[model samples]
Target chain A: MTFLSGLTPYFIAVFCVLVVGFWIQLQREKKPEEPTGETVSTSKARRWVDQDLQDDTEIPAKNDEDDDDDDHGSELDLPHVPYAPPRYPVASMLERSQDFYSLMNQRRSVRFISPEPVPREVIDNVIRTAGTAPSGAHTEPWTFVVVSDPDTKHEIRTIVEDEEEVNYRQRMGNKWVKDLARIRTTWVKEYLDVAPYLLLIFKQTYGIASGGKRKTHYYNEISVSVSCGILLAALQNVGLVTVTSTPLNCGPRLRVLLQRPANEKLLMLLPVGYPSHDATVPDLKRKPVEDIMVHI
Target chain B: MTFLSGLTPYFIAVFCVLVVGFWIQLQREKKPEEPTGETVSTSKARRWVDQDLQDDTEIPAKNDEDDDDDDHGSELDLPHVPYAPPRYPVASMLERSQDFYSLMNQRRSVRFISPEPVPREVIDNVIRTAGTAPSGAHTEPWTFVVVSDPDTKHEIRTIVEDEEEVNYRQRMGNKWVKDLARIRTTWVKEYLDVAPYLLLIFKQTYGIASGGKRKTHYYNEISVSVSCGILLAALQNVGLVTVTSTPLNCGPRLRVLLQRPANEKLLMLLPVGYPSHDATVPDLKRKPVEDIMVHI
Candidate 1:
């Protein structure tokens, strides 16, 4: 009876602590108000282009500057990210373990690709594959935009080039340029148009509604990175070659061109398709396991 | 001749920049001889006992102090973190993508066990499975330390409990304690001894040698997290049930007990085995797909 009494306080203390923790978590869920820096009209005006160009010249000059906040137009009201636990048969774990080992060993990063156009179903299946990644508070703060239209691709290419020109010529200084020197990358912007599919990854830095306030995401960077990893693995698994292209200059330009909302920020541009028949990569080697692992 | 004349200057400029970048990168790789203000010895001594006790008691504590860098082992020489282009084939990509998706869907955070002993070969295969995670510069910065021996498991349990005790008693404030309420986690070291295998994940924060100077690793957090994800998936694929355990106080305690060399930091303690017959999880649901994905 005495031992039970002593343990009672500890149990009660634990229970009380847990209840309070749950309440605090619930309170943390309340969204913050919309940021009041730039007006809606000005923001939209900045991204709106005149949409005038010749067939051979599909580039949209970076000149649109509009601030319109009321245009929700088919804007995706994406819900919180999902965190579904897997359901596997316990009996087959050993066999599955062997299969996973072999599969992982065979896994590699693909740069060179065949020039064959990928089927739409294959792309859809890959996206579906990415849907399984776990996220913070189950808020899978990610968006995957697929672009296949030739005209849109040309427009994207043009805007991206305009941005890249600025980055390469002015924004990216000596250090940045030097770091990227070995990659043999150029702001040619041909891949944006040549690749059969352009998949744009957007990170939801903040969430906003038509009139509702904004919500803050916890561990946003970590959450997004994890999702990206899963997405990359999925794309690779399906036999599609992906080149992760970042629109360092073209985000705002493309936003106006694509009419993206204010809350969504661009993260990566993945051009997915067959690699050019003669595509070649730099000769690189991976660090040995001993250099990376420690057994303590 | 005209084309060659035009490209000559550009090539010269590129060559100059590459030489400078390599020099700078090599300079950055050198480690500082003097220690930072934080001393590892003091912090380790302080938490050593508390860690042992917390494991036996199974109390949930949050010791924020132990999270300090100095408490980890000796700092090692970190390699240059490189951003390289991926390489892989297109056809094999689709097959792997479907397999990963299926594997992910089958994953679960398991805590129950069946008391059945797992074979050494199975454990070896599972660890090998985790070795396949993609890493920055292909560094693969990870270590899997398996503990099945009765003595080692007991020692680990004691070390973990001591730290957890302090966390629940005084170190963890009411708010922090409350947040972890939903998950019924305790510091009981039983899982270490009871489970058939206890896999300790130690992340090489930097690189160190027997006598050579230490090296630095870039994006260490992101690198380790990806490795952990791959490890989790690998374990699941093999048919083993795992509980991803984070010891609030064991970081310093385990470093000392295991006599791990400087440079390695404990990341997670994963207990692996078959589920107990009546293992039950909290009736929690994942966030919706719409909430996680956004289109721009």
Candidate 2:
């Protein structure tokens, strides 16, 4: 039987990912040069995303806060406004919930990836979606580095495997390694090189003000974690697959390799691309809802 | 003019929140008994949600991973198969991106909340959605405490405000307090009582094995942060509003109040509800994208 007839449901998913990947390549070929001095192949993908945000016309009116309700009034010397959001009927609400939940449920942690090209705009949209995550004190303590260069990926792979080899060979105890056996993961990481994009997420412990002053970031880990979660959702929502690969504090080397400022620390290294035709995940189980939640 | 004619867009928002509040009250009034011995109002909320998950027939076949592909084979002992996701055309993909982006963009931090009760099912669904977020080594590492108790909320509020009073009057430096001026926030937080639910998210620092052995959780902060972020999105996606209030290390008091185990620590205390008819957010500004992202 053909691929479609053999796994009808599964092929539908694969076909979608392939079509998007194909579409992205077509868009890239149409316009070889981006205005920001980026070649279509690997333009600083982030610069284009920044460009989208810069070009946004939806800036909330500055003086809108003046319309604040007198009942719950503010004494601050700035404008405020009454806030109201559209409400949907119970049916629409339930429909949306199911739609989003079902979409999210299909997402899985993928390991085997193909060295296929992804459109820059897709990555840009994912990061932009991630940036929407709320931060502590609005510190927004996260920076995304998109690496499409083979040389950089190779270097990253080398260092990460070095750490993993040590981890598998000595650092991790019997229990840890044994637990990973179901997933059948080893120190070898071919996906690091095979995947076309390596998105490095960094968390800024503090911010540098205009005068070079140090501004502390509150709940940095929390803020970055939330953003990264959204990042994964964004990627999955668009049909891309990734594994949250943490190289056990490859931060020192990564910071130097990427030339990141000292304040920024490595949070997650995501190798993003299409799952190889032969990609597979270990059959793992999630704890049931009754086990994880307590209603009081 | 009536509320509707006076501020067309603003009142439309108010009417919606009010209608939802009214609907929830009606729902609670209709059913006054729940299996968990909870008052009909709160009990139906979570039970219905739990029922949804329990009734889900879409659990993937456990042995699907056994269908391994031999084409690009893995040496490990396992089965793998080709993964193909359905593809949408460019227009549809772009539309989805924009649709999700605008929805997220409209999400704001709400403070003034109506005591209008929210369905427990909604909260359960939101939490379940949040749980879908990937975590470090798949440890999950988060617990959600859904507190609808009035007495508990009152007690928690008193301590939090006590701490906040000190933070505003003595603890915070000038710049910090001054920065908050635009938001018009004070030590007094009446919303803690005004909102119907308090979702206190606790992060598990480590897991206690059956034999009382300590199992260290890797990247706990990162994992919990991502989960919390998804929690916020889940809430907003379902027409609810909340504030990510960090009671700066209220862990000690909360741990006591909630009677949580020692291993679990407070991460965030989110008060969830519909915005008060008079709710208003400060006209805050996010840093331009150019400032936050770098292309490498």
Candidate 3:
């Protein structure tokens, strides 16, 4: 009886310590799950083959590690300079619009790129025209890798073709219950090896400002894509042909093969040259302006 | 003793039911937190003014529901047709390339738009030119809503300015701890009211095919952005000036106001017209060709 009474305080102290420890442990486990609790039930569906194009660099929480923003940021408090772009008379403007539309409307994605070598200076000029496109905050966040080397092009073909086959095989396991022969043809990218110039476009996910700190290139993807549109226009004006392709799962390998820095990512790959004599395009019709534009 | 023994079976049965219920509850709670656990740590940072620009239509789990995709899917078989864009002589190609580059280099994001009424037909042709841009799987997922109605333009300005202020306030709470006075001037979007035409660009995240089933538009956002690039080029070709602005937090409100369907999210907004007489621009320089391009 005497020993039991003496040990009561010690037993109570141990009990209190155990309770405090458990409460702290419970708290530590509960923090992360709280903010994300409401998010689960809403994300019912998953992504298909479009996994490579998701660039969310601003978002560290990611998928396939391809998160990057569009190309640019503008300078703060830069001196404003007097500017006036040439204003065309209504008649000239009308004439120019019709002419530009006629030229662009004739442009099509041609896969049969001729092996004939193109002028490097002309290619440079096309890229220079592309660089003139506007970017987020004026951040010109694009890199044009003009690959003319035969061995390098072949290596790119190997990497891209391998990944493409894997993508087809993965799709085959899941939802793609189609004719395997027809689908297999899509996996073989012969143009990668045949083209005179392989234009591999990349977007700088972020930029290095002074002191080596990371500067955000907001809207980098859109800015780069827009630049690509101008490049296409320039190509059409100069009578060149190329097809736009986003190689499935080939970004990382191609990035490594090209020895590009981590800050850059593959956006589009264009095999550029004159079209083959037997060049062909998919028989598709574009929706007219009435179908695409709404006026108020 | 007999009565107590008789109640033991019932008590055991009740205990078993309680244990099973708790096990099921634990399982339900435990899931959903698993697939998303590694993701929480990386997403510590958040998007700022760029939040409105995050058009992730594919990711249904979203902020303000502006999330979408760059799009389209292809049919099993589309017939091919012979295609050969006009081929120019080398001298003509060089001259064309140089002329195009010179023209594109003059293009800038002009903010001060004159209120003079431009011809509607020119705008139509520009939109038509934009529609000609290549999209993911040929999905031309773009909508250019041209607002000339003074009332609607004013209403748009109000919505946009209000949201811009809110965005500013939200940034005020966060890391935008510099030059509030200078930044305040940017939020006052007078051009929205003064421009003859306001072009609102939307990327159709998914398309409605037969039977109202959603058809996936692969790379819809990128595709639409590319189209906008072409539209910009077209505008430049016609000597029209405009400023591209992504209204912060004004997407949903503007989407509802513009009566764009649920599948369409705003990608860009351009107030198009001639430059105001006292027009000025930031004296900015783009990276030279050597810096932006690499040869392998």
Candidate 4:
């Protein structure tokens, strides 16, 4: 009886220690360490596929933790400037609206592309425009890889085509095949090499904090997708053309090929350039406005 | 042995019949009956919730299967007009680009809202602008429900508050709570009622073909998200401010409340209105261009 009573106190003590230990572990997990920023290299950009020495500098890490308020750190902070929109009469607004609609309506998915070199500044502007897309909690979780090297384009095309062959023959069912028939796209992807640039869009599934702690990213797919949409529009604004090509089962290979960090996943591959003279799109009609829209 | 031999012929006959039946079924599923067009109602647009009767005319049915070419059916078909962009000098392009950048940079996520009524035509124009957003296979898989009814808004607000309470109290982890603390948001969402209009964006997961056949929607999430990006830009162009509010666990109830078809799922809830007399956003800074963008 004496021994039993003594053992009870010891057991309770052990339980208390375990509970405290668990609580501490949970707290540690809940708070990730602040990320340390990386120094960006100003070296001339080179295609990782073509050259053995690629720019190994990591993108500057962002601290998403402390951004609960509107105030950001004052280091290199750009002052918020006042903004005033130009007033337009109803007629002008209508005219502008019609013009925009007409212009956007002309955008078509092009496959037969010319290997015309696009200026770096134009591509940069398109990407910068894409960055304005809204995201969940303002976590802009996207990476744009612009590839203009002919050798790199060949490599990407080969990898994509290999997987696409399997997808077309085996992975995709009859319905998917039938749905794609009107587009007349086969397993072959000749435009990947023909296009002057391949804009590979990657979505960061999670953020890597200091000490390699993972931060959760919300709406990663949606955020990247929205950015891609804006990128398309921006390209259109510059009179450039692109086709959205999602290469299924090519992410792992692509990540390794591009030497991307482990946290990123390939979302969509857009081949950007001018359309070939003989380029023709399937005469696909868009759904009527009444079919797609409803007002209440 | 004699009985087995006699049954072999019967088995073969049954197999042949089954094959023929399957082929016939597949054929029937491929081509849907041409949709009978509906006359759009031009009656005075009224708040559907306020009146016992509502505009019941169905949106024109789109023939997704028949779009083998660029031409649509002639019946009530909006003729395609030729597009020719006015050539702007390089200086003008640069000016326009800078102006667009400055204007878009000014866009902030506003929470403090005003109850002043916005014009119906303005709301309609925003919705039409959203319609111009491109979709996968041009399916145009989106439905925007504009809610201005005070009673409906109140109901939506109540429902959202209930879910947000649960999310804040229990569903969210400590990290999530801490992350949102900077934004100073809570279970209370009075803006749902305070905003003059609530644009409920719904994504069509799949198309319900005529006679109940299920048609696949490619890149559904990405397509709808892109449409939403354009919608936000379009709203901005019209000088209207909106905040993106994603109400979790409110989809099923919203579907029932809005009387939407089964194929649609709520994607985003946007409260549209003028900023209150004293509207303020968090001074949070966006990640620098080097952090968010890359060119190689």
Question: Which TM-score value belongs to model 3?
Answer: 0.76
DockQ per model, Cα: 0.09, 0.14, 0.22, 0.09
Consecutive 10-residue window with the lowest summed lDDT within model 3 chain A: A43-52
* Residues B47-148 of candidate 4: C-alpha lDDT, one tens digit per residue: 111110001111212543432322212211122222223434555545555555555566677777778777666666666666766666566788889898
Top model number, DockQ: 3
Candidate 3 residues A74-137, lDDT tens each? 2233445556788899999999999999999999988888999899999999999999999866
State the lDDT of candidate 3 residue by residue for B1-296, as single tens digits: 99999778656655654565467446745784542342233232121112212335434333322222212123433445567678899989999999999999999888888999999999999999999999866668888999999999999999989876655543322112122221213578999999999999988887776545565565788788889889999999998898767665577888999998988888888999988986766667889999999999
Cα displacement (Å) at residue A95, model 1: 5.0
Q: Report the Cα RMSD per candidate.
A: 17.1, 23.8, 25.5, 20.8
How much lDDT does each candidate structure score? 0.53, 0.67, 0.74, 0.64
Interface-residue RMSD per candidate?
Answer: 16.7, 16.9, 9.5, 15.3
Estimate, for each residue in B114-210, the C-alpha lDDT of model 1 and write its tens digit. 5678776667766665565554334455666777777887888888787766555444333223323344444565667788778887666554324
Q: What's candidate 3's DockQ score?
A: 0.22
Candidate 3 Cα misplacement greater than 4 A, ranges: A1-57, A60-75, A172-185, B1-75, B172-185
Docking class of 3: incorrect
DockQ metric, candidate 1: 0.09
Candidate 4 stretches with Cα past 4 Å from truth are A1-96, B1-96
